[model samples]
Target: MLPIKLENIKLNQQYKNREDYFKKMGEQLFSAGLVNEGYSTSIINREEIYPTGLATGEINIAIPHTDYQFSRTTDIFITVLKTPIAFFRMDEPEKTVEVSIIVQILFDNPEKQPDILKELMEIITNQRVLKEMIAAQEPKEVLQHFQINN
Candidate 1:
């Protein structure tokens, strides 16, 4: 499993729209040398093509990300939104979304992506885990929750 470090995740700045938020967070990751220059565009385009917004009914979430080539390492950038952000639905193209958290994962190897996704899916599907993450105010707490849940 990948390292669950609080340093890898952060509280992103507020944005008027999803595009702005992605750009902002992407630049932060890029500046940290985590992702390539074109990573943001690649992720956004990927979302446009296949979509990553997953709806669990009770709490909607979006897993906006791209392949490993665009990143320098395998890590996850988690951002908790003070308010909801809009994203198009993955399964339902006609519908839009109000995502509370954005999990931007960077997989250094394609082989590890499946396992990471599976663990994340398990975490998201559990109401308790989701609630804990949403209520978490500190990065350490968030990392601890991830470790416990995963």
Candidate 2:
């Protein structure tokens, strides 16, 4: 099963920068025992070297993740920002994309995660799904989309 839970879904949060976003999200995940103590720093460092933002559709998205060493479980934390935040584009690191949705991935298995990653990519690129997720009022509204994928 895909590691998406109600507690992991956050909607309409605001953060000025990626660091602040990861810091707050990492705290929640760490408190849930899903990631290591250094998960935030690890993800932020990874982002600097390799950006996760993508222009999948009109509503751009970012998938920030770290090495399995920082992950305690195979889980995904999702957040829809209250306002769009500029994140460096993955394909073109020099460019920035305004992302409305952030999907933070945490997986303990490198070999097994690719399949789930592929599935998530499919979900990410779907314009209808993206719109539905963004328009969601509650956490369950966002959670349903992943549940359907699972």
The predictions' CA RMSDs to the true structure, in order, are: 1.7, 1.2
* Per-candidate local distance difference test: 0.78, 0.89
Clashes of each: 0, 0
Of candidate 2, the 10-residue stretch with the lowest lDDT total is 141-150
The sequence of per-residue lDDT tens digits that candidate 2 reaches over residues 1-150 is: 578889888888999888889888889888988888898899999999999999987999999888999998888888898899999999999999999999988889887678878989878888898899889999998888887866
User: Over the stretch 1-150, how does candidate 1's per-residue lDDT look in tens digits?
Assistant: 545677765653467877887788789888998898899898888878877777776667788778789988888777777787788888986688888777778877888888888888877767676677778878776687678655
Give the Å shift of residue 20 in candidate 2.
Answer: 0.6
Clashing pairs in 2: none
Q: Which stretches of candidate 1 lie over 4 Å from their true place?
A: none
